[model samples]
Target: MNPAPSHVASRRDKLLILLTVCLAAVLLPLALSGGAVATPAIGRDLGGSPASLTWVTNAYMLSFGSLLMAAGALADQFGRKRLFVIGLGGFIVSSFAISLAPSVFWLDILRAIQGIVSAASLAAGSAALAQEFDGHARTRAFSMLGTSFGIGLAFGPLMAGTLIEYFGWRSLFITTGAIAAVAFMFGVPRMRESRDPNAAGLDYPGTVTFSATLVLFTTAIIQAPESGWGSPLIVGLLAASVVTLVAFIMVETRARRPMLDLSLFKYVRFIGVQILPLGTCYSYILLVVMLPLRLIGAEGMSEMDSGLLMIALSAPMLVVPIAVASLTRWASPGVLSGLGFLIAAAGLYWLSLVDFSASKTALLMPMLIIGIGTGMPWGLMDGLSVSVVPNDRAGMASGIFGTTRVAGEGTGLAIGTAILAALANTSLAHRVPEGGPELSARVAEAAQRLTNGDIAAAAAALPEVSRHALSLSYADAFVGLLHVLIVITLLSAFATFAFLSRTRTQGDGFERDEKGVEAVTRA
Candidate 1:
């Protein structure tokens, strides 16, 4: 075949790469937000039980988390471009199947498949650019990648809400599938094939063992609230998880090409740099997801209004990367991560102070402050993470780093949700009481109403005094969620400071080679 015009080919190739990268990292969140809004509609259409609706989310998470480690190794063995195309094909097919799902059970299964496929694309995209470029160019490339990540995160919810408001839930599946197909077609031909020729054979046992460990651990954590920590199911799962995780570590250490190089944590700088990104996800979920619910249900605000109010959190994230990238020239990642945690913690503390009657405008200041705080860490973590690791390990490091962030987010949500649920139940139940049979029945009914998101029903069922008390209790719930956010942020700050600090002496012997950035270590 005749070689294409150089400029035209290059432009086409770049477009394809950018499209695939954004789709891989951002598509799931966009689909998730849209799907979340459509849970009611999906349940009604499929005749699904209330319990089954949660699967629309859980299934995706399970698969995404399940395949993350394997995807990184696959990208290194199979060509990055080749594996990415395969994953894209799988994603599109699964999405189409989900759109045509006959029932909720089928939809959940397909969503899980979609998650597994998406993780491959995500890992490939992160690794591809670093392998494709040299030294400083790679750093610039990662900045662009980080920017795409922020843009996708910000855009998904807004887009999802608009789509769900107009088209319906299944449209999410259709739209995502269409985008994946187009990107796949455009991406496959022009993209360069980049993979580590020196990489060892795939470590199948390590992949299976690690995946099982994560599954069992997450299941145990998620189930403990409902089943009781002492329940046979919870205790058995937890114990099995510990054994499997230990086995995974041992297995990876001995495997031909370990899915994850546990040795990365040997570098104190690398370990410290990751804590910020790892913990940032937790802050992201609480501020964006939980805060919105609190605003609408507890504070008097419409869903749209709450969404608008919450956009401030993301707005700063968009700009922070530029700020953080620039700051790194002068300061180290440790300085950046430590400062970021402090700012985020301050924002959380302010958030905890907002009461039920607080004004929406009053909430904006703290949100903006937190956003500014978050921007540095968000940007700094990505740049520093790739910078501190060796070229060959970039793919592995990115995979593990991203997984840690996701795990932190999942755990944070579970912890925050559990706290809010407990406080809401206890405070409301006490306010409603075991009194006269008729009064007691009415109060119990109101408590159920509050739990179910029917604030109006709860208000109407309670006596005037009890109504005021329940309102106060809801305020207490918001306070509790905020406190949870505060505690996490504080712990994150300390982790960043104590574990992240380094002297300039240790940073002297470092330089980036043609393949990628140089490794930095701590004193």
Candidate 2:
């Protein structure tokens, strides 16, 4: 066969990559946010204990967040294309398996596998795209990627809800898998293979310790309400999590080929980049999970109705990020991101004050504000994450940021859910006449069911507690959670403005190479 012109080949490759990435971005968050809305359906179809059902989300978040570091390193060591293909293949199979799952136990296990492979594909695919652009163009590409992610999150609930309403909950998984398959097919033929020969092998010890740390800590948080925070098992898990975390830091510092370069901590901008995800976790992600619970469980809305209402909360993400990206020409991303947070904080505070008894339209302004605020930082954070590091370390940078982002969601979900449950549980216990220690476990379980948007299940668990009472208690707890998110958003805004600098993106940038030689990387 005759060789094609270089420019023609390049254009073809870029187009194919764009298609695949957009699809991947959409499907990833579709699975996460969509699954959040689908929980009530899952619980109804497959009966399981409250703890087991929590694992339906936790299992995926746990594995996905924990293994990202290793996947990034593997991408750099092996070929990026090679790992990307493998990851997508695994994702397709696992998502399909999840669709046909017989019980929640199998679903949790499959979701875990799905998360693991997703880490691989996300790290490799993002790093591969980074290799193709530099300077403002790089920022634009990543901004596009971020926008695609927003679209997924924006539509995930409505799409999933609509699918579950008509087809079945299982169809959501099938849809995710089918979209992924197209990305695989288009990307495989046109994408060029690349790798960093300098990358050291995966740090197995670091992976194990880090994974163990998350497992122990998240388990402790999720199970604490039922078991009691002071219970021996919960205490032991917390202690072990602390120990493993310390061990992970030690292992990374001492290893010749650490999965994470501890040196990245020294850069203020890098630290700022990491903070952006955590900020979004509370301000945005928490809302995506909990709002549905309130709408469906407390307000007695159908899946389709709640999903439609959610468009107000998530729709700003679709446009605001792109606007912020363009606005960066006039303002530093730091200033824009911080401003966004303040806007979001304003919305969150308003949302807290708004009476749930009012029409749903009253909810729109605050949700839109919150989405716009978070979107500003969201657009730029993706580019900044990799831009702060050398191109050679793109996989590792993506991996580290990916880990922080996903792990934040995992921990945030656990913390947010636990807090909401605890508050509601206490409210329920108080409502119970002469309720004592014997009533605590059932009340806690009922509270969890309430937060999961299973008000009927919650009422069933606490037969003595009126369904109306349970709904009121949950609404109060959710509103309180919103107040907490507002404060976090404000802090995030201040930190963003204070810590991030234009130097990382526009000024002369340098990083020490493997041999201690400082080299100027692309701005």
Q: What lDDT tens digits, residue by residue, belong to model 1 across residues 450-514?
A: 43334565677676445557778767766776777767777877887776554222223345553
For candidate 1, give the lDDT of residue 485: 71
Candidate 2 Cα misplacement greater than 4 A, ranges: 1-10, 131-140, 386-399, 501-523
Each candidate: RMSD to true structure?
A: 5.0, 3.6
Q: Evaluated with TM-score, which candidate comes out highest? A: 2
Instruction: State each model's CA lDDT, in order.
Output: 0.67, 0.82
lDDT of 2 by residue, 1-523 (tens): 5556887888778878877876787888887877778778898999777777777777888888998878878888898889988888899999999999999989989988988998888878888788776888776777677778888889888998898888988999998999899889888677778888877778999999999999999999998887889999999999999999999999999988787777666655678879899898888988887787678667877788888988988998888877777887787777888888888899899898887766888998888888888888887787778766656665457667878989989998999888888888877878788767767778888888887878889988899988889878887887778888888889998888777756346323654554322333111
**What is candidate 2's CA lDDT for residue 333?**
79
Model 1 clashing residue pairs (backbone):
none
| Each candidate structure's count of clashing pairs | 0, 0
- Residue 165 CA displacement from its true place in model 1, Å: 1.9
